[model samples]
Target: MPPHAPRRRARTRRSIARLRSASIDAFAIWRRRLLFLVGGICVGLAAVFMAKLADAAQAAFRQILAISPLLALVVTPAGFGVAALLARTVFPNSQGSGIPQVIAARHTHDPALRHALISLRVAFGKIVVMALGLASGAAAGREGPTVQVGAAIMAAFGRLTPQRLPGLILAGGAAGVAAAFNTPLAGIVFGIEELGRTYEARTTGLIVAAIVAAGLTSLWLVGNYTYFGTTDAGLALGGSWLLVLVLGFAGGLAGGLFSRIVILFGRGLPGRAGAWIGRRPVAFAMLCGLGVALCGLASDGASYGTGYEEARAILHGDAAARLDFAPLKFAATVLSSISGIPGGLFAPSLAVGAGLGAALRDLFAEVPIGALVLIGMVSYLTGVLQAPITSFVIVTEMTQDHAMMIPLMIAALVADAASKLVCRGGLYHVLAEQILARADAPAEPVRRTA
Candidate 1:
C-alpha cells in the first residue's frame, strides 16, 4: 500500500474506535436511565393504587355518614384529631393541601426538604382528618388529602429511583385527584397546569398515564357518577350572553376575594382568641361541629359534605332545605382549612360558588341555572388556582355541556385575570410561601451563616 493510503486507513480505524466507544458510553447511560424510568413507572403505579384505595375508603365512609349527617359531624372530627396528630408528627410538610407541599417539593433545591416521603402515615392521616373536617361541617374537600396520600405513595417509590422522581410524583399526585374526584381529564389538566409548571412530552405522558390508570381504577371500584348530579348546563344564548359575561367578571372578583381571605385568615395570628382556639383544636372542632349541627337542624341537614348535594338540589330549581346554612358551611370550611387539618379548598370553593350562583339563579330566573353553576365553578376555580384552562376543562367536562363552552371559557379568562389583579400569586403559591417561611424560620441562623 502507498504511505498516504496506510496513514488514511489508520486514521479511519482510530475514528471508528472512538465512535464505537462513544456509542457504548451512550448506551450505558441510556440503559441506566431506562432502569430508573421503569422504577418511576412502578412508583407511579403504586401511588395510583394507594390513592385509589384511600379514595374508595373515604367515599365509603362518607357514604355511611351521608345516611346520618349529625353523627358524621361528631365522629368525623374525633377521627380528625388522631389524623392531625399523625400528620403533624410524621410528615408535617404533608399537612393541609398537598398542592402547596408538592409545589415546594418541586421548587426547593434542598434535597433534604424534598426528601420528605408521601408515606402511609401522611395518607391515612390526611384522609381521616379530611373526613373529620367534612363530618364537622368543615368547609373543605377530600381531594386535597387524597392528593397528598397519592403523592406519598409515589414518593415512596420515587425515593428508590433517580432524580426524575419529581415528575413521577407529580403524575401520581394528579392521578390521586382524578381518582378521588373521579375526574380523569381534569386530573391530567391539573397535573400540567398546576403541578408540572411547564409541560414537556415526557411529563405529559407520565401524567396522562397516571390519570388514565387511576381514573379507570376508581371507576371500576365506584362506578360512574359525577360528584354532583348531572345538570342541563345549556346556555340560553342570544340576549343572555351579555349577562353571562357580566357574571363571569363578578365571579372572578368573588373567587379572588375568597382566596385572599383564606390565605390571610389562615396565616395571620388571631391574637388571644385565635391562640385559644388553636390550642384546643379538639374542643374547638366539637364546638364547631355542634354549631353546624344546630344550624343544620333547621333544614333537616341540607348543607353538608363538599356541598355537591346541596348544589345539585339548587341546580334542579328546588330550594335546599337548609339554604340558610350556606354561611355555616362557609364558616366551617374556612375554620377547617385554616386549622391545617388536612383538607382541600376546591370542594368548599365550588360549594360556595355554586351556592352563590344558585342564589343568583333564584334572583334572576331568566338565566339558566346549570349555565350559571358551570360559570361559577370555572370562575371560582380559575380565580383561586389561576389555571384557567384546567378549571375550564374540569367544569366543562363535569357538565359535558358543549353549548356553554363560550361562556365557560370567557368566565375562566376573566376570573383568572381579575384574581391576578387582586393577588399576583395564586392561592397555592401563597400557601407554599407560608409553609416555606414556617419551615425556614428556625433555620434562619444556619441559612444566614451559610
Candidate 2:
C-alpha cells in the first residue's frame, strides 16, 4: 500500500470515531429528555386519577349519609379495619399519608428504604386504600398520597438511569404537588422548601421542567380551574392586620397542638396503653374510626371525607359551616392519621382552617369571611408543614386571591414561628424520622419486590 493511502485511511477512521461520539451524545440527550417526559406524564395521569377518585369517594359518602347516618357508624370502623388489615398483610410500608415515606426515602442512605418506601406496589396500595378511606367517611386528602405516587413512578423510571435517581425523585414529588393542586408555583416551592430543603443549582431545571409538564397535563385534562374557586372578597389592609394577627396566633396554636398529638401517638402512645395499641393495630384502627364517625355525626356529616366542599363553600361565602366543624374535623383527622390508614391531611387541614375562620368570623364581622378563611388556611397549613412560602402560595393559587398576598404571607410567617415554639419540628419531618428509625431496626423485614 502507498504511504499516502495509509494516511487517508487514518483520517477516515478518526472522522468515523468523531461521528460516532456525536451520535452517542445526541442519543443520550434524547433519552434523558424522554425519561423526564414519561415520568411527568405518569405523574400527571396519576394525579388526575387520584382527583377523580377523591371526588367519587366523597360523592358516595355523601349519598350514604343522605340515606342513613347510622350506616357510617358501621361502615367507617369496618373500612378502617379492612384498610389496616390490607396495609399489614398485603402492602406493608404503605400506611398513613405518603409524604413521610417520600421524605424518609430521600433522606435515607439505604437503598432498601427507598425501595420499600417508593415502589409501584406501595403506590398502588396508597391509591386504593386512600380512596377506600375517603369513601368510608375518613377525613383525608389525596394530595399527600399523590406525592408518594409521583415519587414512586419517577423512581421506577429512574431505575432505568441509575444516576438520575435523586433528581428524578425530587422532580416526581414536585410534579405530584403541582398536578394535585394545579399549582405549579406551589409545587416548585414545595420542592425547595419541603422536599429538597435547599436549592440545588443542578436539579433546578429538571424540577421545573417536571412540574410544568405535569401541571400542563393536568390543566389539559381538568381545565384551569381554581381549587377553591374565585372569590371577590378583599381585606382592608389597615383593619385586617389585627385579624391576621389573631388568625396567625390561633391557627398556629391549633396546628401546633395537632402536630404534638400526632407526634405523641407516632412516638407510641406512652407506656402500656401504647404497647397494647401496638399489638392490636386493627382493633385500634377500628376505635379510631369510631371516633371519626362520632365526629362526623356531631358535624352532621360536614366533617367527613376530605372536607373540601365545606372549605370551598366557606371560601366562596356561600355557606357558614357550623362552628363545631373545626374541632370535629380536627379530631377526625387526628384519629384517621393515627389509625394507620392511607390518607392525606392537606385538604382536611385546610378545611379545619376554614372552620376556624368561620367560627372567628362571628367575632370579626368587619372582615370578609372569604379573606379570613384564606388567611386561616395559610396560617394553619404553614403551621403544620412549617413551610410558609409553600403554604401561602398554595392557598393563594387555590383561591386566586392575589389581593390578600401580603396578609397571607404575614399570617403564614407568624404561624410558622409560633408553631415552632410549640412543636419544635414540622409534622412531616417528625414522621419521616420515625420512618427512618423503623427502617434502621435490625428485625425490620425487607419489603418484598414484585
Candidate 3:
C-alpha cells in the first residue's frame, strides 16, 4: 500500500533468487565431492578384491607345486599364452603393469582416447589376466594393475560431472597406491613425483579426499598392518651408513639393467629376432614362462608368484631360500614384464631388493639385517622408478621405519643417479611414451577373410 512497497518486494524477490542460486551451486560442489569419495571407496574395494584373488591364485599355484613342481613347466607356459592372447584380442589396453596405460591416459587430450585406455572393460581384464599370471606362477605384483583400475573407476565418476577428469585420473592412481599399500602419505608423494611431476593446487583436495576414503576403506576391510613388518633397527652415521652406499650402487645397477632389458624388449629386439618374436608373440610368451619356471625351480619356488612371502621371511631374519634369490627373481620379473601378459613389478621388485640385502649380510655384520633390507629396497625401487621421493617415501611408510629415514633418502639419491647412468628415462614414463605413440599411429586396416 505504501510507495516503497514495490521496491521492497523486488528486493525480497532478488534475495530469494540469490539464495536458490547459492543452494544450487553448493549442491553441485558437494555432488562432485560425494562422487569422488564414493569412487575412492570403490577403488579401495577393488584393490582389496584384486589382492584377495592374487593371494588365492598364488595359493593355488603353491598347491600345484605341492602336487608336482614340474607341473609349472606345462601350466605356466599355457597360462602365459592364454593371458597374452586375451590381452591382445579381448582386452587390448590391459597389458603390462597398467601404470603405463594410466600415464598415457593422463597425457592425452582426447577424451575418447583416454576413455579407451582407462575404461572399466580394460580394468576388468587386468584383474582377470593378472590373476591368471600369478596362478600360473608368474613373478608379478597386483599394485600396478590396481592403479589402472582405480584411475578408470575415478574417471568414470568424473564423467558423470564436468570436473577435472585428468586430475581425477591422477587422484585415482594415488588412491590405488594408498589403498594397496595402506600408505596415504606415499600415495600423495607418488601422485606428485611420479604421476603429475608437479603440484596442482586445485587437485590437492581431490587427491586427499580420494586417498582418505580409499585408505579408510582398505583399513576397514583388512585392518591395520604394515606392508613389511616394522623394523626397529636404526642406521648410524658412521660405519653403518656405509652399507647404504654399497647397496645403493649395487641395487641401482641391477635395477637399471632390469629397466633397460624390459625396455629393449618393449621396443622390440633388433632385426630378425624382433620380427620373429612379433610374429609369434604367444610362443615367445611361452618361452618366457618357461624361463620363469626355471627360475622358480632354482629358487625352490621362492621366485614364483609375487615373492612376498619370501621377501618377508628374509626381511624378518626368518628362514627362506638363499640360492641367488634376488637375481633369479629379477630374471623372472623381466620375463613376465615382456611376455605380453598382465602383471606388476612392485612386489617382485621388493622381493628382489630384500634378497639382495640379505645376500650382503656378511659385508655389514654390524648393520641389522632389517636396515640392509630397507636400504636395498629404497635403492632398487628408486632405481627402477627413477622416483627418489616416491621410492623412499613408500618404503618408509611400508616399514614405518623413521629411524632410517635419513639413510633411505641418501640411498635414494644415489640410486637415482646410478639408475640414470644406465637407463636414460624412468621406466613408466618411457613405456607411456611408447604407448602414446602406438595409440597415435594409424590403425592397421582390417584384413578381410574370404
Per-model C-alpha lDDT, please?
Answer: 0.64, 0.87, 0.88
lDDT of 3 by residue, 94-175 (tens): 9899988888888877677788889999999999999999999999999999999999999989989976557889899999
Instruction: State how far residue 174 of model 2 sits from its true place (Å).
Output: 0.9
Candidate numbers sorted by lDDT from highest down: 3, 2, 1
lDDT of 3 at 64: 93
Model 2 alpha-carbon drift over 4 Å, by segment: 1-15, 441-450
RMSD of each: 5.5, 4.0, 5.2
- How many backbone clashes does every candidate have? 6, 0, 0
Model 3 scores worst on lDDT over the 10 consecutive residues at: 441-450
Regions of candidate 3 where Cα sits further than 4 Å from its true position: 1-14, 320-323, 441-450
- Model 1: per-residue lDDT, tens digit, 1-450? 677998999999999999999998898556434533443344334444544544455466567657775675556556556555655665466566777776666666566666563555655556555554554455456676666667766666556545445676676678777776677888877777777666566456655766776676667666887766667667665876765666667767767776777687557657886787668754654555555455454445554456666666665657542345545555556555655566777776676667656656655677877777777777877776777888888776666676778888888888888887776667776676676666662221111000
Name the weakest run of 10 consecutive residues (lDDT summed) in model 1.
Answer: 441-450
TM-score of each: 0.78, 0.94, 0.95
Report the C-alpha lDDT of model 2 over 1-450, residue by residue, as the tens digit.
787998999999999999999998898767766777789988999999999998998899888888899889999999999998888788887888888888788877788878889999999999988888888889989999999999999999888974755878888998999999999999999888888787577667777888888998999999998899977778886865899989998898889888898888988987899999999999999999999999999888888988888899888878987888899999999999899999998999999999888888878989989988998888888777788898999999997889989999999988988888889888888888888886673323212101
Q: In candidate 1, which residue pairs clash?
A: 73-135, 76-132, 118-152, 138-333, 139-332, 139-333
lDDT of 3 at 394: 91
Q: To one decimal, what is the Cα RMSD in angstroms of model 2 from the true structure?
A: 4.0
